[model samples]
Structure formats: C-alpha cells, structure tokens
Target: MRNNHNDKPQWQPATMTIHGGKQRDEHGALVAPLYQTATFAFSNTAQGSARFAGEEAGYIYSRLGNPTTDELEARIAQLEGYPAGAACATGMGAVSAAMLAFLEQGDHVVVADAIYGCSFALFSHLFAKFGISVDFVDMTNADNVAAAMRSNTKMVFIETPANPHLKIIDIAAVSEIAHRQQARVIVDNTFMTPLLQRPREQGADIVIHSATKYLNGHGDVVAGLICGSAEDIELIKMTTLKDMGATMSPHDAWLILRGLKTLDVRMERHCNNAMRVAAYLQQHQMVRSIYYPGLAEHPAQRLMGTQMHGPGAVIAFELDGDIATARQVLDSLELITIAVSLGDAETLIQHPASMTHSPYTPEARAKAGISDTLVRISVGLEAVEDIIADLEQAFTKAQQLKTIEQTEQTEQQGEPLTYG
Candidate 1:
C-alpha cells in the first residue's frame, strides 16, 4: 500500500513535480509499480460486492480505477490545487465528460467564441444535436460574458490564451459572473499549465488540460485530465468516464508520471524560447501581426503576472500575403516540424484556418478573428537561435514565392513587371 502522509510539509513546485502523489510500495521500489491488471482479485464474495457497491475503497476494476492512473490523477489534481482529478483518453474526452456530467437537455452553456476546433465542434455541432444550447461569446471582456449568460446557463467554458489565437480571457471575472447564476465555470488550462496558473484560486470550478500538450512535455502521449472538487470528479468518473469508456491507459498515465518530473524545467525553457521567438516575429517585415502575451504590444500584456505566471510557449501570427504564402512559409521550414500538435521537444507550426480551427465555417472563423493567413507555432525546447533561424529561412522562401507570384500576375496582364 502507498503511504499518505497527512502531516507532510508543503513542498515547492519544483520538488512537487518530481515527488507529488508518489510513494514506495511493499517491495520498496523507488518508482511506483504499474498495476496493469484489468480486475483486482477479491479475497471473498462480500468484499467483491462491497467494492462494486462503493461501500469499500479498493480498486475493483481498471475501468473504475488503477493504481498507476490514480497516482497520475492525484498528482495533477495536487498541481492544480484541486481535491480530485480524472484522466481521459483524449483532451476532448475530458472536456465532453466534464460538461456532460452536469448538463442535461434544455440546459444552456456559455462558451468563449475562440476555443480549440474540436471544443468548438463539441459545443456548436454535437451538443446542439442533443438539444443542449450554447452561446459562444467574446470572453476577453467580462461584460460580453455577463451579457451572454441566460437563466438556463448551467456552465461557462473558456480557454485563456485561447487555442491558436492566444486571446486571454479574465478567469476571475467570468467565474464570478457564472457563480452568480449558479453556473459552474470550466477553464481549459491547457495552454498555461498549473506551473503558470491555477484557475481554482481565481474562482473557476474546474480546470482542464490537453495533457497531450505541455503536461506530458513529450509528444508521444495523447491524454487529457480534469481537476475539480471531489464531488464533481466523482460524478464525472461514475457517469461519462465509466459508461462512455474513455478511460486513460495505465501505461499512458505512467508516461505522464515520468514526464511530470521535468515539467518545471521544461516549462521554463519553453517560455524563454517563446518570448525570444515572439520578439523575432514581431520585427519580421513578412509578418503582419504577432499574438503572444509576452510581447509588450500584446493587448493582454497587462494580465500577464496577475493571471498567468508566464506568457506560455505558443505564438500565433499572420503573414503578409494570402493563404498560399502562409502555407509556403510552413512548407519551407527546414528544422521545424509542420504538425498541428503542440508542446513537444521539436518545434512545430501549423495553419489554423485549414488545420486546427477548420471546424468553424469561414463566417464563424472570421467572426472569431481567425484569418486565413494566420499561422500558429508551438515553440518547443529547441535552442532559441536555431528556432529563429528556421523561421528566418522560411520567411525568406515565402517572400521569394510571393515575388514570383506578383511578377507572373503582371506578365499575365501584359504589363511590365516592376522590381522593388
């Protein structure tokens, strides 16, 4: 059995990352053992019945819980400063299960207009099909959130430094407004991990993460986690997670457990690299606009230290030309990988309009300020100089492509091509 020292001192974040929720087993193994069994053998029929009926606290089945997955859940919950957490198969699973646990037919949800493409689809398309209504509102201004709330609003969902776009939402203000109407507030804390921000302290009812991203720090694992009150977590675990069967694999949880050890150092490197990259992009002539909270000109710069500990590792910027130019820039990158996923050891870039946020129609995307030329990059743990060098080369290639396209257009019109 694992030790639960109730009188343990409050360790710092760095120490907690390595040791939180971990204890030696009967064999005194330094690393926690993975109980990979599907079902635990009961000593007797009475104990089996008691476990099934929730009268006893031992693990009856892996679907209900596993020692490995439980450690992961507890560790993440401790990081987020919540009483409990539930791990899921994917980020969308955590999102769907968290909301579905409390929502019913005729219930309304107020969500930020800018969110992950899958999340937007969940609220705009899938939930609507099931008779649940959602109002997508601009959450940067708390007043917009207040205006969008209805008497039937059961939940308010938001993503601070919202996916791809990097729009910062006021968690405390929105949470306060949601709580007034007896609605739960769920903040997708995927962008800024618990190392940077704790939404629960700011009044958010639950904190969610796409653990596939920063939490894992490596790109191999595809997983999600939600941290909240013990009651809310139990409800999600019993209903959506148990019946829907989006349980996280014990192996995956073990990988995340390993990843958590270096989270503090990884996040620090990510932030430093991103801040340098955002500055470089800001000065590039081929770039139209840059969105990163670390930049001085960022609209949400004032909220940096107050809301989040750092600006985070993602940067979104628009190219000077059209969608083709943006695509060329991504295609021309030599070192950076062109993948939609973020928070990896390798730097990655992707176009949101055709990639991550394509779930939204053109009209809806335009309304959400996602332009066709916008490109999002998840600045990885790469050396800052190497990351910037790759971007510089890509921009040079994109600019050359633009020049050729312009020259060809002039020739087609029977006009002399003017050189700049």
Candidate 2:
C-alpha cells in the first residue's frame, strides 16, 4: 500500500525512500504507525479460512503477515527493483531461507571463497550435515565460477565487494554463467546498498541483505531482507521462511524504514571518506597492502566500475607486522571505534583474523586471502582529515611500540613497503 495518491505523483528515487510504501488512516499521520498486533481478526470464520487458504488477500497471523512489516517489505522491494521481498529476523535468516527455498538435499551450491565467516561455517558444517554440498571458489575470476558449476548445481551465491576483504565479484558475469547452467543466482547485496548497486537489474535471480548493516545504517536494529520475484518469495514464505518462524518484528521494521530515508546521503559521505582513507593507506610506509575497489590498481577495478556505482565504505589493509601489530592498531584508534559492524554513522575498525572471520582456521583463512596482519576498516560519516590523522597516529604507534623500530623511512620514491 505505497502512498499512491495522485497528489504524491510518484516522486523520484530520493523521494521514494521517504514517501514510498506508506500506509495511513483517516488520522493522516505523517509516518507509518506501528501495527503492533500479533494477529489480525477476520470478519468471520469464512474470511479466516479464505486468508489461510490463499483465496483472500488479508493477513491471518503475525508470523505470516503484518501491516507494518508488509509496508517495509514493499518499500525495499520497490527500491531494489524486485517484484517482491521478505523480512527476516536476521541477515542469516534471509540467507538460509533463500537457499533452502530453491535447493534440495542433493543439490549443489557454488559460493565465493571469500564470503562472510559465518556463511562459510553454514555451508561447511550445517548444510553438509543435511546432505547439501558446496564449493568455495574465487569469484573474481569469472572462469572460476563457471568451472565450479555442476549439473546438480542449483544455486550460485556471491557477495559483491565481499565482507572484510572488500573484493568485488562480477554480478552480471556470474549470473549469466549460473543461468546458463539452469541454476539460480543469489547475490548478497549488503555492502553496496541498493542505492549504490542493483543486483536484480544486473541479472541476479535473488538478492539478500544483512539489513543490520547498510539498510538499517544505524547499529541499534538487527534485520535481514530477501528481494526477488513473487513466485520465489512466495515459495520461501510458504515453506522455509514461514516454517522457521524468523519473522521481523514491527518495531524493527519501522527502525529500518527510518534508516532507508537517509541511506542515499549517508552512503555518499561513507564512500567519500573511505576513498580518502584508502588513498592515505596506499601511500603509508608501514602499510603492506590495501584492498579497496576504489583503488585504481585493485584487481577488480574494471569490474567494479561496470558493476557498482561506488567502491563502498569498507576498506581492508595489511600492516607490515603480525597479529600483535594488527591488535595494536585496533587499540590505538582514537576516533574510530573498535567494532565489527559496518555502514554505521561512526567509523569502526576490527581485526578480521581474530574477530569477524575467526571461525576459519589460519590455513583456511590464508588460502582464502585473509592475512594475519589484515585490518578491516568501516569508514563512517566523519571528517576525512580527522580519520586520516587517527590512522596515521595508529600506524606510528603500532610500528614503533610493537616492534621497537622507527616506521618512517625515506624509501626511494615510487616504492611502498612490501611483506612476504
């Protein structure tokens, strides 16, 4: 029930975030009020039967449907250009439900190697116990994706500008490969909110988000979203999502709806700040490597431009030393908070080797390209100068204090520090 009044006139994208999917009553409240009921009453028993039998179009219970949650789903679906969407209690809830909807027990799933740690654990341990098989491959190379496909491959799951490492996968290329094999393509579109990238328009069969990150923007709420065709979402709603009972609450839905309003402007500042931070890190003497799609030399630079509007807010880099050095940088930060979640209003930083991706062993992480010295930074809506100053001071302290050696050096021009 989007605010489709003729007077509203279907305002543009920026306006849609504020005014889209709105439902109001005779009171004419400016914002969508919370429909706090756990169940909706029918006029009579026949109406109730019609709702459960799918013969009528009304909510029967909170688990199946709620007005406030429906409005939030409608707005996200419209924004992401998907025919329909579903709300979940957490990001993983959306992810698990989507996979379970299309994939059978014997079906195979091809996933990118550098995915979120918890997702890696899901495929490796949880699904394997249930007879589902998975393959982890580097998706930056389109050929790697194609090679991993099998006749039983039912899905190709990927994350563009992937978690922690910030690697960009070619959505259109992977989607084409999967579709040709008669497989469904699912893209984790969390890092680059719908404002910056549209995976559905790029040929993805489904899109999922850790709405707790960019979609909610603020750190207070936790929610997940799955966006796709009506048929697919209906299947998930009737089966996997519904049976699991991982429905989002009306209050959390309202909070995420509020976050979507400022998402566009917030992302603009985040991208701006991250690009500046990445540039500074690239030239620093104590930094060994930087991973950001915004960097001109990034491996996925060409693909990032064609697939994404911005390089995104998160940046990952490696210090010249080991875990102790990475820990020092986390402790030395004055402005950036030591935290894991990204896309927040405040800058946050974490040591991925011990924090976000710790579920994987050292050997597995290294094979997946996460180094012991890697530091993942979620740049926020802060001044570029202040953020850069904080990083510079941390680098100095981490190198000098941890190793007891001066990090500053008059290295030959055009040469940056290197680590084996």
Candidate 3:
C-alpha cells in the first residue's frame, strides 16, 4: 500500500496536503486507516527476524512507527520541503530529543535569547547541568550571533518572530553563518506554520514544531514534529526518540492530520485577525507599545516582510501602568482565555512576567525584553469586532483598578502628616 503522490509534478501544496501521503489498505479506504496493533505478525520466523534486522521496511512495533503517523509525517515533510519528518510526544520533546541526539557533553550551542520560556530553561539549566554550554544571543543582530559562535558550537537554535516578543531573525543569514562554522541550524517554526514560513527553504538543517499550536488549530492535544533530511531524522529517531520514548500517540497524530487538512484556511484567518488586533492595540492609549511584525513601527517589520509570508497570530503589548494592571486586563477578559499556551481556536491572553517567564529572574526576563507590563495574546479565529470589544472592556476594568490604587496611595500619603 504505497502512495506515489510525491512523485507527481502537477501536485501543489494544498493538493499535496489532502492527497499527499495517503496509502490505501486492501479495503481501498480513501483515508489512511490507523494500524492499532502493538507488533506486526510475521508469516514466518525468517520474515520476523528479517523485519527485526531491518531487512524489510515494514512496521515492527507501534512504538517505532504506525501507518497513520507515517502519513502525517510524510505530509508535513512534503509541506515543509523536507526529505523526512518525525512526530514526537510534545514540542519540547522534539526540541530536547534533537538536542540530545546531536549534541555531546563538550559541545556548545548558540540559542536565540528571545525563545519560549521553557526552551530557554532547558538550555540554561538542563543542558548546562550536562556540561553542554549554551550562549544566548539576540538573533536579530547577525554580528552578535557570529561573535558568540565558538569552535565547539554544534548547533544554533532559534525561534523566529520569537515566542512572546515577536522578534524576527534573518534565517538565511544566521543559517549561512552557522553552516560556515560547521554548526547545524534548528528553528522552532511553531509561530509561523509551514504555510507561512518554511525554515528549511532558508537553509535550516532542521525545523521543529509544537504541533499543539497552529498545527492542531485547537487546544485539545499536545504534539510535536521534527523535519529534516532523512539521515538526520533517522539519527534522532534511533537515538533520542527511541531511548527517551517521546513518540507521539496514534490518536494525537490522527487529530493533527485532520487539523492539517484545514491548516491553510485557519492560518489565513488567524493572520488576518492578528493584523486587525495589532492595529487596534497600536492605536489604544493604554497600550504603551505593541510588538507585531506586521506594523511599520516594529523594528523587524522589514525583515519579517522578507523572511515570512505574514506576521502570524501572536501579538505582545506593554501596558502604560504595570504588571498589576496587565493582570487586571487579563482577569477582566470575558472572551479570551487566560491560559499559558497559545495558537488555540479561542483567543488566549497571558502576562509573561507573572505566568510564563515567572521562573526566570527579573534580570534574565529583562534581557529577554519581557517587561513587567508586557502582555502576550494569541488571537484566535473569533470575530474581530467581538475580540476588540472584549479587549475594550478589559481596558476599562484595568483603568478602574489603576485609579483605585492611585487614590489609595494618595490617601495614605495624606494621613502620614500626623507621623511627622
């Protein structure tokens, strides 16, 4: 049951997404059927031995591979312009496995400073404990990254339009520099799905995703994917993923496959909604600053235009007051969920200072441009007017809280006259 859809030259991305990696069983089902068995039954002892010895290209165990997961992997690889891909249990699982497989104790890694908070912690804490030194750099500065690279550097890790801040990095430039130094370039492409930006096309050796995000288009499941050359993927699969046991579940893979079918449509709507939200935030008096690549005011707007098809769904803004005010706004929101993760069907608003990056020291958070007043929002597929109205109400509530705090402080100061 082999599908040769990839060999067809006439097929485009949208077409490939629907019919790309599908292989029919004997029943001739149009959709790829899920093989739920733990181990494959062999016709004879020799066949089983050969299958175990890698003499045959059939599934030996569900832990290693499944037909439904394979179809999803192949489809994602085709969409990403990669030779192959591997699905993992979660996005961080993919990141950790890729790093552990490729890097050694003595190796060094150069990472973007503005990355997901957990990813930052993984490198700064976990990798460091293993004697793998990681150097964090502002990827927007090519020269800074170049200077940070050492002879022992094995990989340069980055997330473009970085997690909360939306800082853009020149993927091509960074990849070239890393490659010249004999370092592999790994990009977290969670923010911009392959439909919007293909990191492999820009010279990335590997592209990773928290498919829990846009790939799922809903907050129901947690999944991850890694795309790279077949050889590189095989190495990671044989080593980290196999030993660490971070394989994605069959059910999650199936759900993600369903989500992939509508990925292009969902992302288009997400980008459109995000742009409107960013515009509205930029004009609001309460918003001290907005960080969105779509706006001309953004520092990386030009680079984003060159490297990405669109600005993506996430937006970050700073409040005129402080962290307390930011929390007030989040607490007041009726339509948006105050959750930690992003890229869901419903809008989610979070304060990184108190929520995501709270584990990091204040100085470290400052270095990453995560300020006390900063608020991050993952705009969803909701109606633009309704989303704006919810935000408006939140802003009103936040202002009321601010006014009360100021009045209380003034009264306390007035009462201090008796103490003198």
**Which of the numbered candidates is closest to the native, going by highest TM-score?**
1
Estimate the TM-score of every prediction. Answer: 0.97, 0.92, 0.95
> Residue 218 in model 3: shift from native, Å?
1.6
lDDT of 2 by residue, 1-420 (tens): 434332233566677677667676556777778888888878999998988898998888888988788888888888788878999999999999999888778989999988888888888889899899999999989999889999999999998888878888888889889999889999999999887888987899999999999888999988899999999999999898889998898899989988989988998899999989999999998889999988889866676646787888899998887787888888988998998898899899998888889987877798789888998999999898999999889888886785443332333244667999
Per-residue lDDT tens digits of candidate 1, residues 147-226? 99899999999999898889999899999999999999999999999999889978999989999998898899999999
For candidate 3, write residues 14-113 as lDDT tens digits: 6766766666567777766766676777889898888889998788777788887888888888888889899999999999988889898899999998
Query: Which regions in candidate 1 have their CA more than 4 angstroms from the true location?
Result: 6-9, 415-420
Local distance difference test scores for all models = 0.91, 0.86, 0.87
Candidate 3 Cα deviation (angstroms), residue 41:
2.0
Residue pair clashes in candidate 1 = none
Worst ten in a row by lDDT for model 3: 1-10
Q: What is model 2's C-alpha RMSD?
A: 5.7
